[model samples]
Target: MSDHFLMFVPTDPTWQPTKADAERAVELFKSIAPNAQTIEAIFTDDVEFHHPCENWSGVDCAACGADLEDWFYETTDKVYRENHFADLSVTTPCCGLHTSLNDLNFVWPAAFGRFALESMRPGLDTNEEQEKAIAACLGSDLRKVWIHL
Candidate 1:
């Protein structure tokens, strides 16, 4: 059969998704998990890497995304500047597997390692607890947990 893939990205915060960031994320994901038939990622707000060295205040305002109508500045002699800014949003992602549970467990641990623990928290003092936590993260039929962020 053909390859299967799964990806879960955060709902778009802004109305726009840039080509460069999407391409970059896809490339990064491929380099790490090549056999992945399904890949998911959370959509996060665009990060501004550096400040533009230009005189265009409008450009800076757009890049930072400040809404002027939301903010106003007043000075002497009845001078008022209406500043508009951009709004920021957040996105979170998760992925699913179409392979056997064992295969998924193997690949996921190796690929995630430390980061996995960071994402998945539990009191893994023994095998029973470890399995339980894994099931919870995977939303298996073992048990249900109400986790708070």
Candidate 2:
């Protein structure tokens, strides 16, 4: 059986909200996903990758528009080797330009962040207005990811 999850993360991977702010954001999310089996905020000591699991199409370099699957994986391997994505920096193999992994052009939505507000088996999808409102409440632009595992 697959477990499904919906998560929101800051566009800026390093951003961390205060406990109060997280609670407020959770409350706002709860209003939208009232039927979620579980809804809560998670804070990690270091940034973590949030991908769309089976929905992943691939990622590309934002600058040169080159397929970046191999580069992204190898880079992620190195980044997580020490501090688990303490750094998201990357140099595109095709363009040779510096950028963060979080800035890559993901075919499907994904994010890397130290904080997340997530719902398990939520059985719901959010609209643009709801997403924007939640982002405003969190004081950060967000990336929404749907996961199945």
Candidate 3:
């Protein structure tokens, strides 16, 4: 069994929405996606590593087309082990080019005061239009992350 998650995070890395903002965003999301549920920000300090692909299997170095699974695994291990919440920047072994983890299209998880909304349904597409509405309510641009687990 697997679960799919579409997470929306603030575009500004340092922005954290207030409780009122979250509530408003939730209402906006509910208007368009009636099935979405409000999920309390559990991993408040955890920043997501998102790839363009749906699953980790398709991850590769942009410069050289080399597989990045091992690198991603290692990085995941380090982040969880160290409880690191700061942005991650690394040099790909394949091409030795510098890239910030944010550059790879990852969504930074909502911080302590903010809230994240989620919907768990197989094969549900990330509704960009709805996301934009929520972001507009929150007064910020949002970054979307699709997780298949």
The best candidate in terms of TM-score = 2
Q: What is the lDDT of candidate 3?
A: 0.56
68 Cα displacement, candidate 1 (Å)? 41
- The stretch of ten residues in a row with the least summed lDDT in candidate 2 is 82-91
Estimate, for each residue in 16-92, the C-alpha lDDT of model 3 and write its tens digit: 67778777776666566556544333225455444324454445665677777678668756754675636556787
Deviating ranges (above 4 Å) for candidate 1: 1-4, 37-149
lDDT of 2 by residue, 1-149 (tens): 88999999998999988888889989998888889899999999878899789989899989988999987888888989966898788788897979998999999888999999999998789999999998888889888999888
Q: Rank the candidates by lDDT, best first.
A: 2, 3, 1
Q: Rank the candidates by TM-score, best first.
A: 2, 3, 1
Name the runs in model 3 displaced over 4 angstroms: 12-14, 37-43, 46-54, 105-115, 122-127
Q: Candidate 1, 83: how far from true, in Å?
A: 33
**lDDT at 115, model 1:** 12
- Comparing 1 and 3 on TM-score, the stronger one: 3
Q: Flag the better candidate by lDDT, 2 or 3.
A: 2
TM-score of each: 0.22, 0.95, 0.68
TM-score of 1: 0.22
Model 3 lDDT, residue 21, Cα:
78
